[model samples]
Every structure is written in C-alpha cells, then in structure tokens.
Target: MSIADRRRAQGFTQEGFAFAVGVDRRTVGRWETGKSSPQPPQRPRVAEVLQMDLDELDALLTSTGARPKPVRSAPSAYYGSGDPDEMIRREFLRLMALSGVIAAIPDDEAEALEGSGDDFGRMNGHLWQVYQLARTKGSVYPVVQSQLTALNDALREGRAQAGTLCFAAGDLFQLAGELAFDANRYHDAAASYSLAASASKEIGAYDLWSCALIRSAYVDLSERRYRRAADTLGFARRIALRGDGSLATRHWAAAVQAEAFAWLGDFGACEEALDEAEKVASLSGQGSNGRWLRFDGSRLAEERGARYLQLNRLDLAETALKDALTLAPLAAGHSFRRRGAVLVDLAAIGAKRRDSEQVMQYGLEALRLARISGSGYVARRLRAMTVELGNLGRDRHIAELKAEIGTLAA
Candidate 1:
C-alpha cells in the first residue's frame, strides 16, 4: 500500500500522520500526488511514525512506482544540462518568434490553435507556467506582452477555445497589472486590472475574477483612494464568497480588505478584517506547486505592521515588523517582497519619529532584499521613503540611498 493508504489502514488521518512526521499536511498530499519523494531527513521519522521498517517503507514506495523524481533548484541531467541562461534565451526567442508570426497573420485568415479542445486547455495551462517563471525571474513584462498579443490574435482568428483563451487573457492581464503596480504605475495597473476582470468574468472564473478586482483595488489604495478601493474590494469579497474557500481565496480577500480598512483609518473595521484574516492561520502552509495563493498566515505580522505604520503607531509597527523580520525566511521565496515592504514601512515610521539611525538600518536592509527579489512593488514603496526623508539633508548617506532607489527606476 502507499504510505497514505497504509496510514489510513493504521487508522491515522492524513493530518494526524503529518503532525507526527513533522511536516505540513500538504506535504503529505504532495507525496500522494507523486509530486515529491520523502527526503532522507524524514526517512527514519516516516518509518517510526507509520510503524513500518525502513526497508519496507522503501520497498512499498519503490514497488508502487509512486515516488517522484527528486527535485533540484537547477535543471536536471534528464533535460540534458544545457547552460540554464542559454536555454532561457533560446526559449524566449522561440516564444517570441511564435508570437511574432501569430501577430502578423490577418485575424480572419489565420489558422486556429492546433489540436483538440483538451490540447488548447493544456496549452493555456502551460502559458500560465511560463508566465510564473517570467514573473519569478523579475522581467515578465515583455514575455507577458508577447503572450497576450499571441492570445489576442488567436482569439481573433477563432483558433483557441473560448474558455481557455479568456482564462489565459485574464491571467496575462493580471500579470501586467502586477508588473505595473510594482512599478508604481497605478493608472496603468488599474487599466490592466480592469481588462483582467472582464476577461475572467467572460469565462466565469470567479476566483481569478475576484483576484483581478483585488489587484485593482490595491492601485486605488496606493493612490490613497481609500474609499474607492474599499468599495471595489467589497464587490470582490462577495465574489470570493462564491469561490471554493480553500483558504486561498478567502484569506486573500480578507488580507486586502484589511489593508483598505486600515488606510481609511477605520480602526474598528481594520481590526475586524484583520481578525478575519487571522483565521487563515488555521489553514496555513497549504499551497502546493506554487499556486497564486498569497494568503498564507506567514504575512499576518507584516500586514499588521503595515496597518500600524499607516496609523503612525510606531511602537506597534516596530513590534509587528520585527516579528515579521524574524519569521520571514532568509532565502528568496514567496514572502521576500512582502517582508521587504514591511521593513520599508517600519523604516518610514522611524523617519517620522526622527530616528535617523533606525531609518538607515531598516531602509538599507529593505532595499537590499527588494533588489534581490527584483520586486517592483517593494522598490516603489521604497521610493515613498525618499519623500519621507524630505530634505533630511544633502547628507552623503541620504544622497547615496536616493541614488540606490534611482537604480530601481522602473
């Protein structure tokens, strides 16, 4: 039997086994889904927790052929170790060429996307993966623009499945909005997000549709259109309620609503939304395969710090941001951009308090992390710090920091 099956037979729930094995329940799900193999670190523990011999556990997994190939941060030999950079360049060129050809074709005359409807669905899914890789590497704008052009052309030619095409279009526009928002191009982000919402609505992808709305609301918040943002996200909340509530959709809506409430200085509403967001903790660390669910409770501290910062409650901001800094992982992963933003906010609060030393320490560290992640959003927030610095002097340190922010210039 598989480990999951064996555990069930032994009368242990997946969660029960996961707790005993020192991993998230989603980790168990990954094993069951054949997306991961148990690491050496967990071997003895797995054997002990499941009451099986080490060799027997190994035999069962190996014989069932359910074990995943071990993952690597870098490309594997099975893909024939080409230079990663070179491979990326080649793939980029290939995608660009395809996009160019599709663009040049006359809309009514162009051939449809080749293959069955399932093939088109899979292609759309693959495009989402491509989008993710580009977003992660921090220069996705061009790729997304290219892909969007291709998809648009396909739709014009009637070459793509309507559902797949609309979903892909929605996703691409959302990414464009994200790229623009990170750059502090609020108006541009709002336009792209509007397009995204329309596309998602076309296909009835409620989760994606709500996500686009929430993204647009962020632009309003950044522009200090707090009332507009709150109104917009209220619509999003209703749509999210209709979605699968798998922690992702619910907590994401709650988190953004929390931000909007905080910005409006509605202390009661802000705390209420935050309390709702806190419920996400009960369902934390549950994402698999890097899905776009950013609502994990890991960012709760950071979000709280941001709220306090907006209120100019320096002591509270300091404590929350410090906790966030401690909880945030050192390596580049999901929360890197968020933690950097929190740190920048904390630094800004310090600046308001005339704590130059605190500003230097937190601001520099936040800048370093933001650059490493190439996060446009965090970089833009850092720009606001310059306004906060406000003639602190032509002091060499302040001037140097300004120059550094300039380097991140869109």
Candidate 2:
C-alpha cells in the first residue's frame, strides 16, 4: 500500500498525520502524491505515525520513486584534504551538479509547491552571515552544500514556489561562484555565474542579474583578458542602470570596470570609471547588506591603488594603498587578505624603485600574512611581486624574501 493508504488505514487524516510528524500539511500532501519523500531526520517520526519500522519506512519512501541518488565520490584532493583550495573545489562541484538538477523539472509542475519564498530568503541570509564571519571561506562549504542539497530536493519534488526557487537559485549560484573563484577554479566560477545570471533574468531581478555578470567579468579580468572583461562589464553596467539607483550595484560595476581599463593601459578611461565609482559616497544607505550585494565604497581605496599601480603611477598607488591599510579592519581574516594585498603592491613599488630595504620591509610582512591566512589571492600577488624583483640587481634581502615565499607552496 502507498503511504497515504497506510495513513488512512491507520485512521489518520493528512492534517493529523502532518501534525504528528511536525510538518506542514502541504508537505504530507507532497509525500502522498509521490512528489517528495521524508528527509532522513523526518523518517523515524513518519514511521511512528504510520506504525512501521525503519525498514518499512524506507520501503514506503522508496516506493514513490523520488529518492535522491547516492552521492558520488569526489576527486582526490591534490593539495591534501585539509587544504582550503581542494575542499572548496570538491564541495563546489558537488553542489553545482546537485543544484543544477532543478532545471530538469518542468516549470508548471515546479510552481505547484506551497510555501512562500521567505524561508529560503532567511536561510540564505544566515548562511551569508556565517560566510562573512568564517576564518577560512572553505569552512562554510559543508553548510552551503547541505543547503543546496535541500533546495535541490525541494525543487525536484515540486515543494517550493517556482519564482522563489529562481531567486534562491540565483543567490546560491552566486555564492558557489565565489567559492570557486576563491579556489582559483576560474572556469567553474564562470559557469556558476552564468547560471546565476540566467536564473536572475528569469525572475527579473535586475541587481542580482547584473551582479552575476559583474562576477563573470572578474574571471576574464584575472586571466588578463582585458577586452573581454570590458565588454562584459559594459553589459553589467547597462543592466545595473535598470535596477534601484539608490543601491550601489551600478557603482560597483563601474569600480570593477576601472580595473579592466587599468589593465588595458587606458589611464584616462580608468580614472573616469574610478570617479563614477566614487558616487557611492553620496548615497544615503551603506548600500549593501555585507553579503551578496557588497558595495559600500570600503574597498575603493585598495582597488584604486591597485589600478594606479598597474598604470605605473607609484605615488598615487602608495597614497591610496596607505589609506586602505589604515581603514582596513583589525585582526580579521578578511582584513589580513586585504592588507596583505596592499602590502604586496607597496613592495612591488619598492622593487620598481630598486629599493632593497623597502622591498624587504613590506614583502616579508606580506608573505608572513599570506602563510598565516592561507590566502591564494595574497599568495598570487606575492608571486607577481617576486617576478618584479628580478629587476632589482639580485639583492641578498630580495632573494631571501623570494626564498621565503617559495616555502608557501611547499
């Protein structure tokens, strides 16, 4: 007999069964209709309500043909299991495939799920907080992966509203993209951002959609694909214009555009974009939730400094980077990464000026922080700085600093 048949034979109405199971009536309806099965935590309670053992409950749940497939083994971590890079990549790929499964279901059937989107919004908000507060970003991967799995099951079983699912998918995909990006998996980051953009567009979420495009542009920017990055940023800028102007989305797009222009060696265009980014200072609110839509002009100093440094404007770069260092938060992991980046830029300036003492002073400190934080972003900056030291005439201190940095990869 089906679950509903057993429940009714036991003289329990759907509402009564749901009440005893501590779930919503709609959730019971979904199980009865073969749309979804009980999660592991809910199984024992469900079995008790239907007067069955664990084995009988499993059989009943499986009879619906809605059981989730067993998880596949992930790729071996080349960097070791404890390495944040490997952990982030493995979790990101696993969740990406799971979350993408929602696209397989037909739209109309998917929309039939009962709950409002508020539950998902709240859960995502909490996850974002945990992400921002974590020491290592990879530490948040397990929770995010779990959330994605739950969302996937809900979407597959037609237990969530379609519009809500789209919004959640867009948000979750962006978060996944960030993890992939931090892990230096640029291709995976680009794919996740593309999925986010698609889902945001489906729901007319202009800000979310534009942010996805902006993030996708970063993948191109990192690879030194300046022209492609510029083109993508241009599209993002136009999309952000249609969003709430009171928000910082447009300015964030412009700020990132400045970086592209800097890389392209267009000093004039770069400055123009920087000026446009400064408009965020005049806005009323902080213009961000410190989560998905972060753009309060706090990073502008560092970004401007980085861009000017790219343009060989050492004086301007130093001044801006100093300001960023002063404003950066104290003793936070994120601050360590940010401060390490600015210090590396300063060290690069010292290298260009052929000042060995200045190079050692800044470079060694940045390298120490990179090792402490395990930040790939900071490590990459230090590697580039090492290449710049070749022009410094083989100074012993510079060589020592390079040797120290080499130990990071080991």
User: All candidates' lDDT scores?
Assistant: 0.65, 0.74
Q: Per-residue error at 301 for model 2, in Å?
A: 1.5
For each candidate, give its TM-score against the true structure.
0.64, 0.72
Model 1 alpha-carbon miss at residue 160, Å: 3.7
Which residue pairs in model 1 clash with each other?
A: 112-159, 113-159, 182-376, 182-377
lDDT of 2: 0.74
lDDT of 1 by residue, 329-396 (tens): 55545455766787788779867887777788888988897777777677768876777876465667
Cα deviation in Å at residue 288, candidate 2? 1.1
Q: Supply candidate 1's per-residue lDDT for 44.
A: 43
Candidate 1 is scored at a TM of: 0.64
> Best candidate per TM-score, number?
2
Candidate 1: regions farther than 4 A off: 1-138, 283-292, 332-336, 370-374, 390-396, 399-408
